[model samples]
Target: MFRPENAQSLVGLALTLLVCWLLSENRRAFPWRLTLGAVAVQVGLVLLLFGTPGAQTVVSGVNDAVDGLAAATARGTQFVFGYMGGGDQPYQVTNAGALFVFAFQVLPLILVISALSALLWHWKILKWITQGFGLLFQRTMGLGGASALAVAVNIFLGMIESPIVIRAYLDKLTRSELFLMIVVGLATVAGSTMVAYATILKAVLPNAAAHVLVASIVSAPAGVLLARIVVPEKPGQGGYYADYGSLLKYDSAIDAISKGTMDGLTVVLNISAILIVFVAFVAIGNSLLSIFPPVLGQPVTIERILGAVFSPLAWTLGIDWKEAHEAGYLLGVKLMLTEFIAFIQLGAVPEGAMSERTRMIMTYALCGFANIGSVGITVSGMGVLMPDRRTEIIGMVWKALVAGFLATCMTASIVGAMPRELFGY
Candidate 1:
């Protein structure tokens, strides 16, 4: 069995916590119980999911399910886009270049998954799962009911959609609790996007689905722990729980799917627009940077700048020093742009450019929605949900983004600390 990279993992974990501590509003009253408990929970999950045969079987099942889902999406695409959606063409070209049609493949999955999630919610299956986990968060971390529920549901729902579960309690939540909610939102990826990411990275990492699921689970508690450390709960503000009965309801099963499809379309369009604009901006920035001077006989670009800036952090996460810069570039891309772009770029990383270990570390690290753009989404979405908390939400966005970033890194460290045997290395 391959041994854990214990030294690097320890440094990563310490550095992640230290960064959170440095940014803490009240270092003296740090929630040690919550912090330690969250770490225990993350470690337990990593061992159970990565080291056990039974859990591996379940992960395989999820992978199989995702494959089926992807196939279904392909059928729908074939019906609409014809051969462009992977259907057979009348004649094949002698040397056809690969096409990157975002509309035909990537965006459609979002709509399908969103609709399925809505159907599950309508059946109350999602409610049970969310509530069960919410209760666990409440008991283990001593979180108020509303905050715990919001964090728990976030595993399945998007950040903005999750707050709707505790909408009744949003205005009443303490500043600390509200901030925790925002951090949880940024820390975890939604189910729809999670599957999309898994599909994108499937070629590079065969077990992408399992890792994404584990990342979401581990980050929830990590976010809570970091949020508590950064801004401790005030005196006389504990044990408050929102009634589960206050959840929003759908008109019917059909309504749920239809509404979900519509919502997913909006998300699809937003993602397309964001990618087009942000990617163009990056290209523009790189063009300008390239004019300055050459670096090591090559023109300086945005990727090189990001890699140089974040290489040390990547090394702490158990990436080999030689390959850390490349890994760091992916992390920086995720933070500056989006995880979707980062994953796409990751899959396209030339063979032998980095070791498999480095690729795995970057995959775990970048599996979050903590980009700069998400700050505006969280602030505005929560602002509309609870108009009174708009000012508070805006104030907490930067800190929440930092906490979310640290939380994902914490997950990476825990995974890195696992014996390579767990990853079949």
Candidate 2:
């Protein structure tokens, strides 16, 4: 099954690692052991979640929740369009396929999941779970305590919310630790987005939530390795919180829902604004490209160029060559534009343009905000949270962004290449 495309993808990943190392401020002093340990722990987590029946049940329950949301969206679509959303209307749909163009179209799951997650946190369920994971990271990966919490919270919460959990110590984090946080946040998607992603990729990829969920979980360690290489941890680094109790504070269920909904609203608004401009720009670019038609030379579009450039990388993740380029185009758009924009485009890919495996891998790869714009946001947001360390945050932005992008790529490669049965597909 291994082919030239696979080799190309591997080479691309290797090149990314090289790029990370070359860009590091102190690559010479990188902590190799710690990096390897983090990778090992991540691999183990993936195995436990997917391999064991009991663990799979829990994860599957989460997946079921996302699936239910998708189904509900279909119903809501019907309610809004008066049977048109029920597959009755073939040609006329909104900008991104107006299935149910409303506030809750596919994003309500974020509110639901956020509320539930907050409840779990209030009940100490997530706290206990993350504590064990955190202990392993501390003992094995040798990561700073606050950074570990950020990574775990990233698996559950939005980037902005996760960092606030450690707000008290933000000003004290080291350069390497802060970089790791930024990379992890950018590499992983928030739980609220799972339903939207599932809805977009479900037609082409089986077990969409499973793949996306696993991708975020696995990206943590990959982010750690890349971040460390970019700015090696100071051997005797101090000022990291080691105790868990101080950081784990939970309000009641009502408070959780209220706060969680507000958080989801911010995400929704951000997605809306970003998409309006990004799509406009893409349309403009396409219009410009349309001038040079097949009459003079073959028609060229932004998607086509991206597909050609990233197709090899896509194939390395076990995607068939026939569909690799389309998948690659999606990845390129996700990285350069925004994940929401990419997901919308993904839903509209011509029938049979991408294979199941390729679509699945692209979904995982494009789950987070690993683009250049996110780098600026993270640096600004986290810098303000830690005003004393603004300079350090600025220093690590570029490296963290690159690391985050590569981490998602690495996660896709491993998960996509593995046995499909692992995803219950």
Candidate 3:
């Protein structure tokens, strides 16, 4: 029998489609075929990983790499926060009960990981991986080579920096191509951000890095589909031309490591500031809601209100109603606010706030960069790299935002639909 949670996930999927209908600028002209194609890519990811041993072994290998990295992060966390990095067991007194210190702690890992990843790329490991994926994207989605490289690299690099891969092509990209770039940038999490998010989600999900890595990999093709639909592909578009032969002239090994470290620091600082403001906002919103009449003898908060509003959708996405409201509220917040804040809230959920299934479902759901703020970030960052095409970048922001959200939701649905056996449950 299909679990109620499975049925609920489908319901959430339907609601997401409804949201797309309501928000799309030209609803009558929406490219349903490409939208469905994006969803199909997500489904394929789940099936290949879960249904076949060969595929599972491949995914498991990737998962092991992620796990190894995450374990390193945990040890680093232990060094910084002591036992607070682990559990609340006795004989373990923690340094700071405050949240700010908690967030600041272990942030150094971002720098370490960033520097290491740059070294890996400098050695051509990540470049080959990204190019291989880019080639596959070009074949399947029929995207331009330059655009495919940018999107694939964005999966492993920050939004601002990924466009540098195709610096020569940026200034010459067409309007539709520019839109695709923005959409892909806004839809996927960069590699540096993934480590930060893993720290946040680790408290809720057992294998957070594995889930995050998978989410980004799966979202890549979805981003391609959505971008193509947002601005239908133009025929006779010139293909991408690369100057990688002289990439070392752009940066030596030491230069790449230093540059990556600086970029990661900026990202870490931005994250710190955003978390401070969002947490305060959540507290204030919840405080105001507490003035309302009690429901079931409990004062209401924004989390509960969000739960009430999004619970049905959550149920449809394969989460038990017992845990649906909390998960649903996070999804709504992720869409309306930012994925970073939603992830923080997800981590802080009180024990018993969600079931194991709900936590697993949400780990995939809240894995994108689809909030309104990212729309602006994508435009500005890409605009700087391709100043001549600023108008085209501006035009695609809204469409990219909408399409990116749908692509992430498509991922959530696919993961939710897979049989428990596939997940070894």
Scored by lDDT, the top model is: 1
Off by over 4 Å in 2: 1-13, 52-60, 69-98, 248-251, 293-297, 316-318, 419-425
- Compared with the true structure, what per-residue lDDT tens digits does model 2 show for residues 1-425? 44454555555556557778888887677666865676576667677777776876777786787777667656755666554455466665565445555454565555556666777777778878777766666677777788888777877776776778888777677767777788888988777776677776666666667767777777777787778888787768843775667764656778876876776767777777777888798889989989776533567888888888987767766677777787788878888898877877776676477556566667767878788667777877777787777787787677677788888887776565456566564
Task: Sort the predicted structures by lDDT, highest score first.
Answer: 1, 2, 3
Query: TM-score-based ranking, best first?
Result: 1, 2, 3
Tell me how far the alpha carbon of residue 101 in candidate 1 is from the true structure, in angstroms, after superposition. 2.4
Q: Give residue 395's lDDT in candidate 2 (0 to 100).
A: 72
Give the worst 10-residue stretch by lDDT in candidate 2: 1-10
Could you tell me how far off, in angstroms, the CA of residue 218 lies in candidate 3 after the best superposition? Answer: 0.9
TM-score between model 2 and native: 0.85
| Higher-TM-score candidate of 1 and 2 | 1
Residue 213 alpha-carbon offset, candidate 3, angstroms: 1.0
> What is the TM-score (0 to 1) of candidate 3?
0.83
TM-score of each: 0.97, 0.85, 0.83
